[model samples]
Target: MKKVIAIYPGSFDPPTNGHLDLIERGSKIFDELIVAILRNPDKNPLFSLGERRAMLEALTADFKNVRVDVFDGLTVDYAARVKAGAVLRGIRALSDYEYELQMAMMNRKLQPDLETVFMMPAEQYSYLSSRLVREVAKLGGSIQDLVPEMVERRLREKLDPAIKLQDARKMKPGKRA
Candidate 1:
């Protein structure tokens, strides 16, 4: 029997509980699940590629069938290179469904043999997203429930320095307030 390998590609700046939920579910569905992180140079990311990979690796360590990897360029191309038979995606809302549908169609056009599988995270994490997690962390809001403990710590470490720098700039040179 041929092993079914699935690639789940995303920027994953800071992988959230929603992402973990998908990974857990996908791991059970596929023989192997590769959590591929896209290295996009155009957009500035909250966490470095290494940091993101590290967090995903740690978060998914318990899933023997799941692995974390980094990739650049087109996701379909990477999926082809890895011999992945399907691409796994998560849809949390109507907006996501629309976009994912378009991408899935385009990917089919590019690689007719590859399939796209869409899954929804648990209802509790239906509204969760990495962007929202980053926004909350950046504004000094609590994110304990949105992400794992390790990710929360890393987010704080990555954002605290910037927050301190911004606060330092706001203070007058000689004034101690």
Candidate 2:
């Protein structure tokens, strides 16, 4: 019997809880689940590709069936190259469905053998997204619940340098400024 392989490709700027939820679920369904980071130079990502890959690796380390990887070019092409039977995507809302449906149709046309599987995150994470997490972190808002602690730390460190300064200032009440 052939092993089932699936590719979950995304920019994963900061891999939010929604992404992790999908990864966790996908890992169980496929014999091997590759969580691929799209290497798009045009995107001004808050987390570098390496950083994102590292966090995913750390986060999914417990899942023996899941692996973290990076890929460039079209997702369908990448899926074909990796011999993935399907492409996994998470749809959080109607807007996401419209866009993803179009992309899935196109991918189906491009690679007749490959399939697109859309899954919805748990209700608690339905509204979470990497872009939203980055925006919240950029504005120095708490992202403790949005992403993993490691990712949260990195996001704050990369997006808001002043957070550290403010924290230090708070630690020394007398040196307020």
Candidate 3:
């Protein structure tokens, strides 16, 4: 029997509890789970690619089959390079299906044999997202539920003390972008 390798590609920015849940669940079905960190030059995340990878590695340290890696360019290319049998996606809501479906379709076109599998996260964490986590953390709100303690600390270090205050000053009323 051929071993099944699944690729879960994302910016991760800062992996959260919801992400961990999906990863842990996916690892059970595939012989190897690749947690790929894709480069997004457009995103000025608080965490660097290396920092994000380290955090994820620490979070998933217990899963022997799970490995952390980084890649640039198209996901299909990465999937093909790794010989992934399936691409793992976590669906949080009905709205996400449209985009995910479109991506899956495109990936199928790129590689007909490659498959995409969607996993619905647990109800309690379905609504949790990286944007929400950052917004809460930016405003001095608690992120205990959305992220791991390490992620929370990283967020504080990167955004708190002085940087967050500087950003707040630039946020004038009616300035929404």
Q: In every candidate, how many clashes are there?
A: 0, 0, 0
RMSD of 2: 3.2
For residues 82-143, write the lDDT of model 3, one tens digit per residue: 99989999999998899999999999999899999999888989999988888877776667
The lDDT values for all models are 0.91, 0.88, 0.90
Clash count, candidate 1: 0
Residue range 22-87, candidate 2, lDDT tens digits: 999998889999999999989987778888899999999999999999999999889988999999
Instruction: Name model 3 segments beyond 4 Å from true.
Output: 162-177
Q: Which is the winner by lDDT between candidate 2 and candidate 3?
A: 3
User: Against the hidden true structure, what lDDT does model 3 obtain?
Assistant: 0.90
* Candidate 1 segments whose C-alpha is farther than 4 A from its true place: 161-177
Q: Across residues 28-139, which tens digit of lDDT does each residue of candidate 1 receive? A: 9999999999999997998899999999999999999999999999888999899999999999989898899999999999999999999999999999988998887787
Better of 1 and 3 by lDDT: 1
